[model samples]
Target: MEYEAATRHFAALGHPGRLSVVRLLLRHAPRGVRPTEIAGTLGMKSNTLSHHLAELEGAGLIGSAREGRSLFYTVRLPELAALIAYLGQDCGRGRPDLMPTHPTEIDMDRPFNVLFICSGNSARSIFAEAILRSLGGTRFRAFSAGTRPNSVLNPFAIEVLERNGLDTSGLRSKHVAEFEGPEAPRMDFVFTVCDQAASDECAPWPGQPLTAHWGMPDPAKAEGTDAEKGLAFAKAFGELHRRISAFTQLPFDQLERLALQQHLDRLGEA
Candidate 1:
């Protein structure tokens, strides 16, 4: 199957809240569930739950219908089947012994490593690193770097992130050189988050990591009053959170190498 649709499906399932929502709905399939019931059971805010529901519907993972003034949602079994099949279609193509027959065979303990790069690691790249760690720390170890490293991280970025419940402790602006050698942690994925870095000369990462461009404005350079600048930081943080949240939900063990790379590239698109 084409990878774009699978990316959307994976992105939809990435959020912890949405993943829970889908599983709960799956248990009550056919009969379906109302928003109130879902929110009550999950102990989630109504508005927040609504947003998750919308995402699930958008990805074709769930469906909704109006039942006399109340809305009900159910799993889209066919679409779910399609996603599973796509992930396994190329599995063990020439190596039968390597195929995963059970979920336990998936090597999740070998956490994936990721690196985010930009001209200055004070804003977009730093935010991407933090958000991914916060959301997917169990499966990923994320790092950020700058070609032109700053003496310290952008204070405004830290302030805004802390206000939104993220810990800003120990995060510092780092030079890309720190991760360049054979002894350094090899990255499984590398993302360039600014136009300057995407086009500028840079040292190659050691592993030939899957790469993508997710260019965003340098919120650290936002020209405005503090409040306005904070708004810019928040906006950039939100976008990174969404993308990283989606990234963590992919079925890594199930997908073929080429298929997984396609999804990663599609996810970089705004």
Candidate 2:
């Protein structure tokens, strides 16, 4: 970072309110926190929180995105990394112990929590959840939800899973809100398997999981004879199986956050 840039970031952090905002954002990390949540947590009035957020954003310490009716603020990891590097540049000269270390590994002590989302919890997202459940073994715990979940799982989706020897007894459509509460499992990754769900506004996930759009055509929309509709569901299952298989093969312990994010985005295109 340039001297001017470093000074600007330092100036931004000079205020106690701005520093507190940064700390709160860091706790949320990759996932964005809504302004209301931030204000509530910090006990800052709306106008005061807005000013601090703007200052931090202007200094490149944070970024924001609009999701439905909510605006979410997230820490700018690269910029934060650069600022830390600038501050610790001299630490390598003699005191290596004082130098910062970047985390390249994810916690492996517990099974990684994964969520698959769609507009309806009927087919694509359900298939993904099941595929991951079977293939992921003890390494992953998978869940699925929808923006506007149907009353039940799509019959074709269930048939396809059964034909492939996947368990369907406990599977059911679920609203995304079910996973947004404080008691919900903290997801490590969340994927949207259809365009509608990818574009829909969703509640911010609890853990601010790494997210990506893995959109595919909705198999339930197929109109044809039973065999043809079943074929469509089968095709959807095949695509999801391929993606989830690739996801499980990633070198989680070796890739850092940015690299892993890039990998996830590319998987959507694949």
Candidate 3:
């Protein structure tokens, strides 16, 4: 197994703001930035940015060294290299032309493609897909669609995603039928996060991707005042965050099909 510290490092970098900070450091490699300067440049409050910086440092992406009374943060080249190597640890396999120098530890010769299915594909499923897309690395790709499609993406869904720093400009809603065609994209995993979509029997497909039910409650169905509705969205967001963390943490290579199935089945059980 690769270093656990390195995985935590990658997890810390998964956040959009943190990813931006890392990119900034990469652009200014060798030359370190001070905490105050970083906060000012990112337009983030000193306290908020400091918390994020500390997390990055804990993950070993950035190193802090004291310079007189000030602390300077510099990108750690070896750490960055390790992160890249970890993500690419399972690159090309069985093909001479596609051999990868930095293969990921997890099996990525076939990057797992996951599809999230739900009734409307407006709130819960869309949120799950976006969270995975934002959190999951190159080893996994995520898509979502509704069994009975909606004409538009839910406004609240877009709001929550954007608040979490995900770009919703490119997201769209579609019917599950789109994936049934012969030319549809290959799926390695299919998850129905709502009870309705999980029970529906549908057409067969290639790979016969493993199926699981997450039973995430529908935020859109929440009724009452604006505050109550917002609470529903918050609840859904927290649930998705917890679930996505567990899903990406899976060691696909180490587990057999049955074990993997059991692991996925137990997700969100708590």
Q: Which candidate is the best by TM-score?
A: 2
TM-scores for all candidates?
0.59, 0.63, 0.59
- Mind giving the per-residue lDDT tens digits that candidate 3 earns over 1-270? 166876798789889888877866653445566777677666778888888888998887889899899898878877777666555564322354443332223345877889988888888888888888888878788898898855578888888888889867667887899888878888888887775565354676565676666776788899999779878987897897898789899888788676776687678354
Expressed as tens digits, the lDDT of each residue in 1-270 for candidate 1 is: 468998999999999999988877754443457888788777899999999999999889999998799888978977987777776665335354544342233344688899999888888888988898799866899899987855468888888788879878778899888888778898888888875566455666665676777777788778879999899999999988888888899998898666776687677664
The lDDT of each candidate is 0.79, 0.85, 0.76
| Predicted structure 2: lDDT | 0.85
RMSD of each: 14.7, 8.7, 17.5
Error of 1 at 89 (Å): 25
Give one digit per residue, the lDDT tens place, for model 2 in 102-157.
Answer: 44556778999999999889889999999999999999999999988555688999
- Model 3 compared with the native: what TM-score? 0.59
For model 3 the local lDDT of residue 10 reads 70
User: How good is model 1 by TM-score?
Assistant: 0.59
Candidate 2 lDDT trough over 10 residues, lowest sum: 90-99
Model 3 has how many clashing residue pairs? 7
Task: Please say which candidate is ahead in TM-score: 1 or 2.
Answer: 2
